[model samples]
Target: MNNRDQKGFNANDNSNFNIGKVVQNFASPETRNNSETKLLNAVKNEVALRLAQSLHRRVYVELDKTEDPSQVASPWSMDVKLGDSPSQECPEGTHIVTIFDKKEIGGRLLILGAPGSGKTTLLLQLAEELVQRAEANAKAPVPVLLNLSAWKTQYSDIRSWMVVDLKQKYGVRKDIAEDWIETERILPLLDGLDELMSQRQETCVQALNDFLPDWTGTPLVVCSRFEEYQVYESNLGLNGSVIVQPLTDEQIETYLCRAKCDWLWEAICPDRDIMNPETGLARSPLFLSMLVLASDKLPPELWRQDKSAKERRRILFEAYINARLSCPYRGGENYQVGSKKSDRRQSKRKPVRNPYPKDERTKRWLGWFAARSVEDAQTELFIEKLQPYFLKTRPQEFVYGLVYGLVLGLVLGLVLGLVYGLVVGLFVGLVGEKSSNTVETIKISWRSTPRNFYKGIQTYIVYGLVIGLVYGLVIGLVVGLVIGLVIGLVIGLVVGLVLGLIGEEIDTKISDNQGIYQSVTNSIICGIVFIPFGVLILTALHYFHEPMQLSEILAQGAVKGFLLGASAGGLLSAIEHSALRITLWLFGYAPWNYSKFLRYCTDRGFLQRVGGGYRFVHALLRDHFAEHYDPS
Candidate 1:
């Protein structure tokens, strides 16, 4: 016999076996390069798509910057020192991309700004430029924009977190993502530093400092609010930092004119006090955009009111919501009531109808979402991540658990039996009540057969033995041993072989809708697989004990199999989630169709879509809604 027969296979023995190296040996360097190129292109496209969605077709404001010592690591403590030249200071209107290229800065940059100061916008713009360069040159590092807020819950190690983000968000293969991070092929553009809890901010900075040492050659950009960042004792070990300055009076005038907000400028120009540089709402690009969007609906007298900057901002957000709701639908052509041609077309085509809730209802729902997000320290809101705590009241929680358990138990019990149903219902209800807040990310894919035929047979043999033992015992207790042993052996062997022939894997495209679709598909597969097993069991039992008609036995078995398989597979989970969502709707916490509402909010400029989830366009707006939230 060969060495393989004498000595069993050892995966760690590279001389004998190594799946990765074996594959690599077969793949040419050119093929590897082409694969990497495709991955980089995908990363670039994802970044570009995010930029377009977040920017919302708004004009790019030329933000000014100054080298701020207060928010940056001291020169003496720095790994790279800024030269003793006054020119090192970033002049007004210096392109952000240029700042990264400066030898003194060396691409490790910290961006600091106040709330609503356009820090994220600046980072996204920089990312766009870097992505373009990476796309043009294969040697350049691909830019990836990630929110640091996920670090608190997902991972402690920055490098591991980055690899997972690339895999989860950009659909990069795990092996490829790991290779890129290890080789420093991607520039990390991390945002939302201030979104972490106050206590964890210092720890996060320390983590960044630790991570930066290993990532010496790679470019890293981090963004945070100056106020929150300044309080942290630890500072990011970066080459240099720049603070975003507020818009000056001249810049404000220029932007207003470009936006065709002449009426707004005319109104603001008369009251110089209202435009105070320190307290003015117009100093921030975000508030300015809101002003421009809501200008027509906002009466001039509201701007003239003597109110604190905070109060004025609140008023602007309220006005903006009202304006968006009152305005005619901008999504498509409005079919007038008078035209018969339009009516006929609308009837036949079933033109898309507006899905937005009423103005007040929309605000309330948004407020609840924002409030929950703040409490959970979550920046990106995934619909699947909604937890039991979201129900708010004890009664609501009890109802949710009860309903979830009952639905699951009922479906499962119908196929199994009454004893199984009661036991399952009690167990599920107890588990549901004590369920943790974290949502486990599920991945699913379909395959007709196991990849390895021998391995499949080995797995099925074990499965068959266990199933046969249990089935035989149960059947023997109910009927004769001869019949029990024969039926159990046949049933177990058939079921095991059938199951072993099928396989599953994770779908790399991690999106909310994609997940739901995969879950449904898995349920169908489970139903189909179990149909034959159910028919066999029911038919044998009827023939031995009750002597039912063959047709009746077969029909009953098929129905039982499908229901049991589908429900146990994934349909039950879907049902539970939907039931909870409906309960939340009943409580007026959210709409029944959360995905649709969130997408609509994105279109209205209140939220931005990030991968499969959504986040408020700005933390400032989210806070505004949270502060004014009245659940009652």
Candidate 2:
């Protein structure tokens, strides 16, 4: 090759032309793209699997083909529309995904259906399809399924909320989720718009409209009940919409026959004038599933009996709960056991014995929990949310809490006090047995350091125990007084462990003040710090159990934490030398003289001297004394 042709790595040149460098430069973007694509697919598959497992587990009874509207009969498809008004019908019969494909405008789809119309199932099925498509086409947007019921009225824009929801619900990294959302690389499949407050539905629709820019072409899907969505007159600006068709009588009969539920078929058959309001519910997939489940126990006469739709649904719910509770636990099927962990499938465990042994008792608790859920407008039940409900049911919640607190304080205090007293007695006996030649310093050492350190720990333990016991007792009494003992014990143990390990010492140091003032200052500091710490600890605990609204947490946490902090401060102040002397002198707050009190406590092994000052042998005694002094 000529020199001129070789310029800038000429085409024919092999020598001095770096193949490795060229390859590296050429392959960098391709390799990165491939890696990122694989990561995205993994995330999609993981999310899809988790969502699918949860759905299947929740709907444990197999939904046979006979029960499906599409398979057994013509799948009920809704009219396609742009916005709220009906548009020209281009397709004769189609499912949700086909509408997305054939739509002229953007792929924003709103699904309208009745309560048991299988809208959720359709959305999940569509999401699965999109997820599969995304795997093949790297540029295809990933499908993210979200429960609209869990979407609180926080975000003004749906896009912003989608980012957060993906991170929280699907375990997607915040950064990756944000990148996908901002880049329009995700198709949000939102289910349960009907779960929100009626007033909030229009607001959500408006938020969706506001979220999409004029130039943006990102697709989104929403599911809502027909009645609920119709309440809002405003159109949800979408390219396509459809309603899930209700199950027909033939479909219901076919399912019943296939499941060997002959009695149930007779109850809702055409011969019984099944079109009437009483027997009309047979058309709903949910009610049919319930019937199929309860057919063994529920007599056909029960279904034929005249009753309101609401009454029938209540009966069905009761029967459903009864059947599930009575059945043997199969891993994750037990509702009462295990937390809703981040990884749903991995977290499943063997069934736990329910506290309520009888099915009736379990059903009653379930009813109570359901009532509480309705009151709170919660779609999912958590044990933590029921804590407040338990208190509300008890007319004497406060009285019970106070009485329990006092009882626990006294019992725990007496036991701890006696144990420390015995130790003090032994130490005194030992010291008396020693020779007089022994230095006073060794005697002080024996009395002060070990004793005070031991007492500090005791105080923390007692306070935590007392607090935990009182809280748990109050909750347990409201739930079931019989279970209060177990609840209190567990709570007390957790609190004690947490407090004893993390408890801070009252710093007996103050500028130019060596004893009482220093201790008083330390108490104040401890109280202040405990406020946030208490909130953090309690919030974490509650989040894992029965989750509550943030507002409720803050209000309740602040009040309780403040009272706790003040109690601790006053209790800590009692141990300081000058403070004790002044309080006793000024108001006769304590019965004994300051010096005599010190000697009495020291002799009892309840306190130990540190330089010119004294501290309790255990923080428990100190806290008890403080609590007694400041009863309020």
Candidate 3:
């Protein structure tokens, strides 16, 4: 061994120069290649494992600082990747923050930013960490990976889905899943109302109103396209937010260099002048992976193969990863729940050459990959695939929703009517008494004139309002209690039975869909978005609960207090009715009724039968409940 032959480690060469020992370990070309391949595989494994770990760990979650709701949907981080030393010099206080510190005093993190701003990537990284934390705990090793995309449209009733689906599919007993998932307690995380609703003005503020109360026990992190979720950030009063910004050129270079492949560095380092060069776009994990693969094969000079860099890069990405997933609908089969009927997606795509011509049975494979491409022109109606409900029922969701809501509407009308009746009834009685000359009328006044009594023992306003309120409340409570209990029990029993038994079957026929969720969420967010405003409803039954017991009720009660009492139940019934109407409206959109309305004939005979037109239609009513529905 010559010391002159080794420039860096001559002493090590002198200690052992056994080239035979290093090279003669394998006898055959296959064995040697296998051994070399194993070494390469081990090296590759370490790099991927380390890089993936770093990608997750290096993610910063800055805590504290009040955020603008508008700022929330911006990149949750001004910069997602570790940037390079600025070419123009680093700005002070940039990339320095309390990101690693826990921001517990505030609400759950609401990661926001523009599309492609790295919010989802960063959150997935964070989720990886959370899942680890849960796994490390002595109990509950399996961490649930909730896809917000899937979650926004998952079984709306998660409890039933988990219990029923798990039992049927996984053979896991409902009891076990309930105890372990504590699903009801964690419903808040799965509540993606913000995502489900259209992200526009006042959306964030509205979403916050709906979301904050829904979350519990576990920490929550939401990722949304920046502009979309900014709607809620301000109203939520979140203590902290991080906006992800695009990586600078130098940052792009540093990442290129750190890829530690001479191939990658040379491939991406030279795009100094082009706007958003393919190399510069490599900040994204999706793009980053492409760079690694392209780097392995192409020279630095070859990366500039396309003249328009941005266009070239688009092609580059498409060439590698297919398309960026814009919706859960676009994602693969795993995202979907199994349909009872087999997916007819086969008839969907115009089958050309099978990507994997070797496998004749592509459809049968659950997660099979077939590279064949199916192209559709932009103007085709087949591009839109509707959920099963719209396909199965011609359009009955609205009808069901409307009928259910109308059925429940009687309750709302009764409540508001009682309030109207009680006040009106009392005012009439007070006025009657104050103006009366009868000795009997003197004690109990039915109608009274205004005598602004300030302990002169009763102003007409006070007396009338008080008496009417009291009588209204007493009668309303008795009526509501009797009616509500009977109605609720009967309706609930019938609905519950159907829902519990045939519900699994019927539920599939009705999907709340996005609009329904949004409507309910909107009403929730707006506070009055869910209120019923129509008035001048029938008030006949509200005057008294069968007038015979009315005197007995008023005789013992304080009119004012009792009216208020009656009003509470009425208000609840009203609120419930309003909520039901909103849901029904969602099911049976009014716009869809035009076709049926148009079918009506305007003939003289038809008019005669229908009571001469508009008045007849208004007066006549018919229920169209299904056989499953119990009128009681």
After superposition, which runs of candidate 2 have C-alpha atoms over 4 Å from their true positions?
1-95, 151-154, 171-177, 271-279, 299-301, 328-356, 364-632
Candidate with better TM-score, 1 vs 2: 1
Q: Which candidate leads in lDDT?
A: 1
How high is the CA lDDT of each candidate model? 0.64, 0.47, 0.30
- Tell me how candidate 1 scores on lDDT: 0.64
Taking all chains together, each candidate's TM-score versus the true structure is 0.75, 0.49, 0.33
Superposed on all Cα atoms, the candidates' RMSDs to the truth, in angstroms, are: 11.5, 24.8, 25.8
Best-to-worst lDDT order: 1, 2, 3
Worst 10 residues of 2 by lDDT: 435-444
Candidate 2: tens digits of C-alpha lDDT, residues 1-632: 11111121122223212334323333323122432464455445534433333322223323333333333232234556543343444354455577766534345667776776567656766776787777776556667667676556777677667766664334344555676666556677877688677777778867765664431445678888888766564655555566665655666666566555667787667534334433456666655666665555564435555766666655555564455455544333222211234324323444455433554433332233334444444343221112222234233233333333343343233323545634543333222221111001001112234655566457767876777677767866565543454445554554454344332211211111233343345445445645664465447546555577887667655544543443344322222232222322333233323333333333222333322233332222233333323311
- In candidate 3, which residue ranges exceed 4 Å CA deviation? 1-101, 104-107, 113-118, 135-144, 150-208, 214-218, 230-237, 270-280, 296-310, 321-632
Name the candidate that leads on TM-score: 1
Counting clashing residue pairs in each candidate, in order, gives 0, 13, 45
Of models 1 and 2, which has the larger lDDT? 1
lDDT of 3 by residue, 503-595 (tens): 011011011122223223332322221111111001122342343244433332223222222222233233333333343235432212221
